[model samples]
Target: MKALIIGATGATGKDLVHQLLNDKDFEEVDIFVRKPIDVQNDKLKTHIVDFEKPEEWKNLVKGDVAFSCLGTTLKTAGSKEAQRKVDYDYQYEFAKAAKENNVDDYILVSAYGADPKSRIFYSKMKGELEEAVKQLHFTKITIFNPGMLERKDSDRTGEVLGSRIIKFANKIGLLESQKPLPTDILAKAMINSSKIKSNGYSNIKLGNIFCFAEKSND
Candidate 1:
């Protein structure tokens, strides 16, 4: 199968690309990014394009599965509109392109607590993206909602501190459902969910994401 990924430079996206390159199930792995990455593999293809100008590269979204992991934090984006551009506009554009190109499987990395009617901005944006993609009517759509991701070598102070707090809580047998999820495991679950033969939509929450990742290859 051919796999197309956005946000390949991110923590989860990096893990996903590595896993896809190593997995025998995927014959080709294509990544779209603003700049080129250092990794090289026979099955990997890199497309450095401007996300703001999708018309130039929208036709290149063809693949068996399209994984959308692009996201941004308010601190990094500097404004709500800027964050929306990356988290919602960019991902939605990619998904729209993939659907137009006839890609059947769509996998998304959404955050936990996402709801279209969410009072929080971040959750509302993610929820809105989920609804927008659903309107596209893909043959298969898998959305993963993970809480407090345990990114490898994460530099964000808030994320680091939050993860530590969650870890401590988990050790005390509290908030186990909110335990931080490793990026690699989430990547594995995304790939594994694509292999499922089901038609229509699937919403994999925090606990279910752990199970899917553990049983991915099975």
Candidate 2:
């Protein structure tokens, strides 16, 4: 199977790309990026294109599955508008192009507590993107809503502290199911979801993600 990925340089995207390249089920892995990635692999293909201009690279979105891990933090984006552009506009554009190219399986890494009607800006944006992508009518669409992610060498102090707090809470059986998950586990779950034969749209929340990932590993 040929798989296409966006945001391949991000933490989760990088893990997903590595898994896809190593898995025997996916014969080819194509990554679309703003600039060239330094990885060298026989099954990996990198496309450097401007996300703002889909016309220039939309045609290359053809593949069996499209994994979208594109996102940004408010601090990194500098403003809500900039964050929305990356989290919503860019991701939706890629999903639209993938649908147009007949990529039947679409997987998106969304966030927990995502609600279109939410007052929170980030959750609202993620929820809006989820609703927009569902309209594309892909044969298989899986939206993964992972809670706080524990990434390796993460620099965000707030996120790091939040993750530690969540972990501490989880030890006492508080919010056990919603415990912060590692990026590798989330990536494994996303890859496993692609192999399942399913129709219609499905949302995998934090607890479900952990459960499914554990079962997949077994």
Candidate 3:
């Protein structure tokens, strides 16, 4: 299968790209990023495109399946408008272009509390993006909502602390449903879901993601 990926540089995206490039089932992996990726493989291709200008890269989004893991933190983005651009506008644009190019299958990495009617800005943005992508009418759309991610070698202070807290809670069987998942596991789940023979849109929450990933390993 030929796959196109957006946000291939992020934690989950990086893991996803590595898996796709090495997996024999995937013949080609095209990644759209603002900067170059250090990893190189025969099956991997990278496209450096400016997200602000969608017209320039819209045609290059064609592929069998598209994985959208693009996101930005509000702290790093500096403003709500900037965060919205990265989290909502850019992602929505890529999904729209992929749909236009006839990419039938799309898998998105969404957050746990995403709701269009969310009172919080970040969840609301994600929710809006989810709603917009659903309107595009892709043949297969899978939304994976992970509660908290345990990234490998992550330097983000808040995420590190959050992961530890969640992990501690999970040990005592508390918040089992929302246990923090490893980025690699989430990546595996996303790829495995694409291979399933299903129709229409589906939402795979954190617990389901963990189950699917384990099932794939079996």
Candidate 4:
């Protein structure tokens, strides 16, 4: 199957791309990025695109399944509007194009506390994106809502400290549901979901995401 991905440069996105390229089930792995990457593989096709101008690259979103892992932190984006543009607008547009291109399956990496009525700005944005994509109505939609993702070689002081705290809590048999999940594990779960023959929407929450990662291939 052909796999399409946005946010291929992110930690989870990178892991997803690597796993997809290695997986026997996926014959083509197309990644839409703002700049060229160094990775080279026969199955991998990188499309440098302007997320701001989806009209120029929307046609290339064609694939059997599309993965939306695109996001940005408020610190990196510099403002709420900029962050929303990346997290909400860019991702929503990608999903729209995928649906328009006849992609039947869509897998999204959303946060655990996402709700359309969320009080927090980031959570609200993610929730809004979720709703927007669901409106597109793909044949199969799987939303992975992970908490405290344990990214590889993370440099964010607050995130690293928060992860450590969560790990300590996990060791104490507390907050097991909120455990810091590795990006690779989440990537595995996403791939597993796409392979499953399902209809309608499936929301994989924090604890369930771990189980999905361990699911045996058929």
Candidate 5:
């Protein structure tokens, strides 16, 4: 299988790229990024692209499956509009191009509590994106709704503290369902879900994400 990935520079996405390259199931892994990366691999194809100009690079989106993980925080994006541009517009454009190129399978990293009618801004945006992509009618669609992610060397103080708190609670057999997921584990789940020969849409939520991650070990 050939895999096309966006946001390959992000934590979950980076791990996804690594796993895809090593997995025997995938022959090629194409990553679309804004700037060129130094990493080199025989099965990896890195495409430097401008998200605002999808026309320039949409053709290269062709592959057996496309993984969409591109997103930004309001703090990093500086505003809701900027965050939407990255989290919604760019991702939607890539999904659109992938469907147009006849990529039948699509795997998306969405958030928990995502709903089109959500009052929360972030959840609403994610939910809207989910709906838009579903309308594209991919042969197989997997949406992972992981909770707080435990990123490697994360700079976000709140995320780090929250993970520690969750870990402590988990030790006491509390809030295990909300245990922060590691990025690599999420990546594993994404790859494993792609290998499953299923049809229609599957929304892998918080507790289910842990199940899929554990299956990665098996």
Candidate 6:
């Protein structure tokens, strides 16, 4: 299978790329990024692209399944508009190109509590992106909504501290549902979702995501 990915530089995306490259099912793993990545593998194809110009790279979106996990924090983006450009516009454009090129399956990494009617800016943006992609109507669409992702060697002080706090709570049998999810687990779940034969829209949220990771493709 041919796999296409956006946000390959991100924690979740990096794990997804590693898994895809190693998976026997995938023969080609294409990653679209703004800058070149250091990894080298026979199955890997890296495309340095300007996300704002979809027309130039839209043709390369063709693949069996496309993974969209691109995102940016408000602090990193420096403004809501810039954040939306990365979190929404770039991702939406990639999804559009994938649909246009007849990619039948798409897997997206969304956030917990994403709702179109959400009052929170971040939640609302995520919700809006979810809705936008759903409208494109891929043959199979799986949206995984994970809460408090546990990234490896994370530099974000708030995220690292929050993860530690959540782990302590989990140790006390509290907030199990909100336990920090590891990026590798999420990547495994996304790969597992693609192997499922059934088609249509499936939203795996929070705790259910863990189950998906353990699911057998056979």
**Each model's C-alpha lDDT?**
0.87, 0.86, 0.84, 0.87, 0.85, 0.88
Flag regions of model 5 displaced more than 4 Å.
201-218
Candidate 3 per-residue C-alpha lDDT over 1-218 given as tens digits, one digit per residue, 9 for 90 to 100: 99999989999999999999888989999999999999979999999999999999999999899999998888889999999998999999999999899988888888888889999988888888888887887877787777888889989899999888878988998888777788898898888988987644344444635221111111
Candidate 6 residue-wise lDDT at 91: 95
Error of 1 at 62 (Å): 0.4
Candidates' TM-scores? 0.93, 0.92, 0.92, 0.93, 0.92, 0.93
Q: Candidate 6 — which pairs collide?
A: none
Segments in model 6 whose C-alpha atoms lie over 4 Å from true places: 200-218
List the RMSD of every prediction in angstroms: 4.2, 4.6, 4.7, 4.2, 4.7, 4.0
lDDT string, candidate 4, 101-165, tens digits: 99988888888788889899988888888888877877777777788899999999999999999
| TM-score of model 2 (CA atoms) | 0.92
lDDT for model 6, on a 0 to 1 scale?
0.88
Q: lDDT tens string, model 1, 1-218? A: 99999999999999999999999999999999999999989999999999999999999999999999998899999999999999999999999999899998888888887888999999999899988887887877777888888899999999999989989999999988888889998898888888888633344454635211211211
Q: What would the TM-score be for candidate 6 when compared with the true structure? A: 0.93
Query: Better model by TM-score, 1 or 2?
Result: 1
After superposition of all CA atoms, the RMSD between model 2 and the true structure is 4.6
lDDT of 2 at 6: 93
Candidate 3 Cα deviation (angstroms), residue 101: 0.5
Candidate 3: worst-modelled 10 consecutive residues by lDDT: 209-218
Q: Where does candidate 5 clash, by residue pair? A: none
**Over the full model, what C-alpha lDDT does candidate 5 score relative to the true structure?**
0.85
lDDT of 2 by residue, 137-190 (tens): 777778888888889889999989999998999888898867888888889988
